[model samples]
Target: MNKFNMTAIAVAVGLIFSAGMMAQTMSKDDYQAAEATIADKYKADKANCDSQSGKQQDICIAAAKSNKNVAKAELEARHEPSAKHDYDVVVAKAEADYAVASATCQNKSGNDQDVCMKEAKAVETRIKADAEAELKVLNANKTAGKEYTETGMKEKAEMTEARQEAATDKLEANYAVAKEKCDALKDDEKDSCQDAAKMKYGK
Candidate 1:
């Protein structure tokens, strides 16, 4: 199978790890137990990866590593329960995602690999920007000691801009993927594919 198939498997594994990490708020006593659970889960995940061979093995290992980081970040967020810690968890997941995508893209060749890398970076940039914007609003509110119901104009503006940026990132990423697919087609068909993508994304 292609590396893309392996990447799909990796995504599934990561998602399973994410599901395993969710829990209620943690006490000091609960911290050790959570850490142990994360470690055990990572071990099991890595074992699964170890069973695979070649590029599949690499992709599976990347997923395991990403999940481990995500699980640790989640545990920290649960233990500390602050905006900063929460943002850290988000960043961990984002970075972990990019790691897997980078690994998968590296396994491919030519335009597919190139576009996949670009799309991965675009996705990571969008997610990090969203996380940062959220942090800014959160820190701003904390400084003002204001409730969420009383958000200021600046916060609203930040959110609006963030939304627009995210939208653009998604559109551009989708466009890149779509256009790359068109490269495999003939002249008229390729033109149609490109035209269709632009029409759909208004690019």
Candidate 2:
């Protein structure tokens, strides 16, 4: 129920997710073993969640699911390290974070909850946008990296465009969170808040 406890659960799951990503190419036996390990971990996580009640339990369940999802995605990333798979890993991480954030927001009410949800969304958006940019950059790097061929030039351009678009997406998400916070204010204050957000984000 406490913030630190929830955060610890999230961090613990995330650490496992990170470690899963570092796995090298595996033999059939190794892959199966890892797969089994993931399954066992998920079961253990779920069992731990069973000890809590109500909203705390829901958050625990969400965290457990997040852990399982990220583990699965990381497993695939390890099994096949491609732009698409790597992107999947990032997506998993984003979703995992969002799940926990959304669950935690239940602790708040009214505008506080709204802001919490919006902030969660902003984080998700940034992560997903980064994933997209990273995937595009990886695809672009499929070309002659660091070498100045015509194709390389095109690849570099694509990479730059992807990153720019991701940055724009992040900015827009931030603006949304700012605007959502303005909802807590009244009339002129709210209007000024929104105006400032628009100016800050170039919305």
Candidate 3:
């Protein structure tokens, strides 16, 4: 799809990968294996930078180092899933991106370099802010859902109580009317009429 969608998908894949790993029982062996993988990849990536010289070499080395750091952070996060760990992953990615962008900016000179660095920082800040805002919104929606559910249950209970009270009042009013009619009867007949009213009204 679009660039933003692609970037989001990539990041989501990484997080999903971590979540899958976390779903399993993590062990010391897993941790050591992850560390070894990162180290090997980093070494290979750094070796690629040796072919270049000057600023190009510096940029390549920076990118390799950034990638290594981000990988390690992601591995650690997967090993221990927590809010702080997740946040660390986000922060790591942001810093890595900034490092790459900043290194690339060094390839420029004079006023152009200043503008490049400024733009890089601006983008980094915006990305980080957006991430924080998304986290806050997610938490807020969860809280609101809980509150709405509780309120709904309370209101349902109150409505049920009100209905029961109204039924009782209606039954009493009906029994009063029946008793008034029974007043027209005499002695034993009146007692029989009152008994019928009591049975009909469940008094």
Error of 3 at 140 (Å): 5.9
The residue ranges of model 3 lying beyond 4 angstroms of the native Cα positions read 1-25, 136-145, 148-203
Pairs in clash, predicted candidate 3: none
Candidate 3, 25-113: lDDT as tens digits? 35989899999999999999999999999988988998899889889877877787654555566767777777877888898886567
Model 1 Cα lDDT, one tens digit per residue, 1-203: 23463345334432433343354577777899889888999999999887789887888998899899988987887776666666677778777878888888878898778778777766666566566656665555554454444456566666667667756766777777778778878999989999998898797
TM per candidate:
0.62, 0.83, 0.58
Give per-residue CA lDDT, model 2, range 1-203, as digits (tens).
23453344334433443354455766778778889999999899999988899999999999899989989887787886555766777688778878988998999999999999988888778767876776687678878498989999999999999999999998988988899899999999989999999899987
Candidate No. with top lDDT = 2
What's the ranking of the predictions by TM-score, best on top? 2, 1, 3
lDDT of each: 0.71, 0.80, 0.66
Q: Cα RMSDs of all predictions?
A: 6.4, 4.5, 28.6
Worst 10 residues of 2 by lDDT: 9-18
Candidate 1, position 108, lDDT:
84
Query: What lDDT, from 0 to 1, does candidate 1 have?
Result: 0.71
Point out the higher-scoring one by TM-score: 1 or 3.
Answer: 1
